[model samples]
Target: MEHEEEEDRLSNLPKIILHNILSRLPKKDGARTSVLSKAWEETWYTFPILYFSDGLFVGTFPQPWEGFLRKRKNFIDYVKRTLLRFYDNGLAIKQFKLSVNNFELHYMSKDVDHWLKLASECGVELLELCLPDGPDQDEEGRGECYVLPNGVIEVKSLTELVLMGGIRVDTAFMNHSIKFFSLKVLSLWAVLSRDEHAIEHLISCCPLIEHITLKCCSVLIPNVATNFLLESDTSGVMKSLNMHGLLKLKTVDVQGIQEVYIDAPCLEKFCYCPGDFDAPFKIDFDRCQNLKYLDLLSLKSSIITDKWFLELFSKFPFLESLKLNNCRMFERINISSVQLKVLELSNCSNLKEVNIDAPNLLSCVFYGGGGSEPIISFLRSSSQLEVDLQIPIDYLDLCNLRESLQNIKPQNVLSSLSLFIFQPTEDALNPLVFQVSSPPPSIKHLHLRSVPKNEILFSSVVNIILSSCCPATISLSFNPFFCTKAFIEFLYETLMERKEDGCFCGSGDTRCWWHGLKDVKVTSSMKIDENVDFKTMLELLGFGEEISFTLEV
Candidate 1:
């Protein structure tokens, strides 16, 4: 009888341990465990997380109109029954995740509201609700918006709230309502606000919110300025999203916003993507002393002048990483920030000159194409630098290109140099081929892509570059039509010729350059009618054994 009692004790785990085990299992699997014995029946009911997703009940009905409706109804009934069982058992729910893809919100609005209230009463800490498109969709099927009810926002026990779908926030519920004292993270996707104040009031209530992500949201009005947008401007016109009082907030990611006023002193990271239509954004950093990472993209109208740029760096003295994309404001950019480590500038059409004086910099990338070449200079030698040139075919001139290449100073630390040249049929390569000078000796990787007719020019360019830099790896991206076995053989012959011409290591050692080439990658997915296997061809040519071939089809 003592042995039997010990076995029973082992089978009957403590309530806390049993609840934890069941909570980690899928809802259905955990519930099915109740069939094992009466001892396990109550364990499933007390499971903290109740995740009811319609996807779990897929294929329950036939693929037809009636079947679709039946499945949605069954999902609703299952969730209702599950929540009711928890209530009947007097169990508390700590987390809840609900996803309904097909249910009509107008018919099930009452049920959703009741479920939220039940979850709140059960002390739910994490709530995730994904509803279908809006109840009142337009005739074009373009609008899929859902309005969130008050019970979800008023849940004081919620620590993390993620509301997706075209949900509209009812600001009226925020006034005189209970604050979310415990809420720390809020994520809203395609959420529409009734007015700007509604969002402001909602944010004021969540004083503990640390991370906020607003993607494809509209009608965010600022309290400091009356320049507000109407609810009808669904074209993603965001006036302002002020971060004034939430001192504990750390990271904010916002897209499709026009203007943002940030005053949070403790903010560490910020990502902003401005829309097509935007006013000049105003950002004051009197309090944001802890700001570190910033990414700004799609700056169409809001140009950053030299003075404004200096002021920005001064305000955020501790910023570490900065990225600017498609911003066409400053013709000349000069930055001298000590704390900056990584800097990237891309697609700045009007930018002509860039001078950086960051001592702690580690990585820098510049993308300039189809315009007058920009002059880039680094005051201090830090580490890796990548220069990518995508000059247009119409503007392909050897003199201008040579001048642009000469403008970049102190090229001893460049790691990768990539050039994409597009030459028209009428353009002659003789001028550019001879003018193409050698690259920096420190470059370790070189990539070249050009039109098939300009193969000789590219070959000459590559030879010049390899003669100077002698990179260990070379990658060639080409149309399959031109990248035949003969073309690769020609490249091999060129490298051999360079080896014989005393171009290897300046010591006249033939084994230094060609033998040192370690990797050759050819990326071409297009099917070539010509039958050519790169591996067999390279082997037949007696390329060194140490060379590895990467032929991606």
Candidate 2:
């Protein structure tokens, strides 16, 4: 009796419990369990979620065309047989995902349409279709794309719909009435539409959509004689996206659109990237008062002025995170907010000064450009605030780096600094004796990354960083093709040879802080015993891509 009890506990589980276990596994893995036992096989056939993709046979084909044809036929036959079995058994499909390349869709569009119709009839709640573009095309210079079937749109059980790449929402959709009554999340990426109104009409019908993403979508509008249509044209791109009265909407990300106007009061996050920077760009979300995150990119300096920031904070009182990228700003800008916590600025090259006064700000990231670093001042800030500075690769000079360190108002507030350095054409790496005038800042960590052509450049970069700041920890990541063994050996030997009374530059200047170093620890993926020799440590690091040195002073 005891042996029988422990024989097969999994097969004795209830059917509902066994089905739940199979639902969490990959489709291939779930199918592999059919040979386990008769009870497990019965549970596998009743799995409600089905996902089919041509990606599984991508690299399996050794001979290009001959192997691809065999893989294609197998994939199609498998999908048809599985769906027919579920249909014959009267089982419900909760979710269905199909991904195929452009080459496969050209010959199997009708098969895809049949599968989608069956999924709709079986009440699929979540449906995702990904058809990426390929090099093959027809005589009209247009790639083959699958037109979305009307039967799929009429499904009242769908709660999430994601369609990406090589899919067309054509005039048939515009003429038919959409009935996506239960959709809550809708994402359309790189989809083509016949006219601008087709996409807008689709969005207006989905009243319950909470999260929406429209990116890289193009609209081909016919030439109309009316002035209203011509005035609103955005060339070949979507002219404008207007979302109003979406009460349940919370998140929206839109890219490659000329103008955007949203009036959703419950919106919490919004990210927008304009299609054309030279043309006039207009964005207004005046009614979204509860927004917490906003990211804008590529806006001109004439649009975002000092007064524009003042109006922005006043409009959205609850915003906590803000990111700006490649958006030109005026000479001076001021950011004063009480609810802001995270701020990031990237390649805003025109600005010369920035004044921040956020008492709750936790972190700020600044990426320097080719010009001089901006003067950053914190009038009022949190006591635990941290700052990150990223120096550009082209501006990686000792003088420029030192000037950046001195510009911070309260220099001790900097928590981390990253340097992207390369070897200079001039002979700045020559062994010359230089003296230190003052001690470097107290940085908690310093990260150095390079793709240098040789080991001499790597050594020079490390020497320049040590002279800049005295970080407690130094992390280095470099090209793997370089002499890793030699670099590690050089680093280990130099750190162990430094004496408490010796100076790095050999200038007899005791002011250098490294003279007081007590110990150095090197860390990598492989473990190193404290009793390990120098050669053993180098051997361990030969296979590691990144290594860190922790200094004890």
Q: State which candidate has the highest lDDT.
A: 2
**What digit string (tens of lDDT, one per residue) describes model 2 on residues 392-411?**
66423554566687777778
Model 2 error, position 510 (Å): 6.5
TM-score, cand. 2 = 0.87
lDDT string, candidate 1, 1-553, tens digits: 9986875685588988888778778767888988766777766666778888777765644478787777778888888888887777777888899887765565666778788878888788999888764434444543455557777767778899888865778666776658888999988766667676566667778889898887766653333344553332343355777777898899888876656777787899988886656366544445777889888777776458888679878988889999887777678889889889888887877888888888788877776656677888888756554544343323244335445555676665456655555554654555343322333254556555443345555555444445444455555543444333444556655654445443433333233344455445543333432245655534443321222223111
| TM match of model 1 to true structure | 0.69
Error of 2 at 89 (Å): 2.5
Clashing pairs in 1: 134-144, 134-145, 146-166
Looking at candidate 2, what is the lDDT of residue 141?
49
CA lDDT, every prediction? 0.66, 0.77
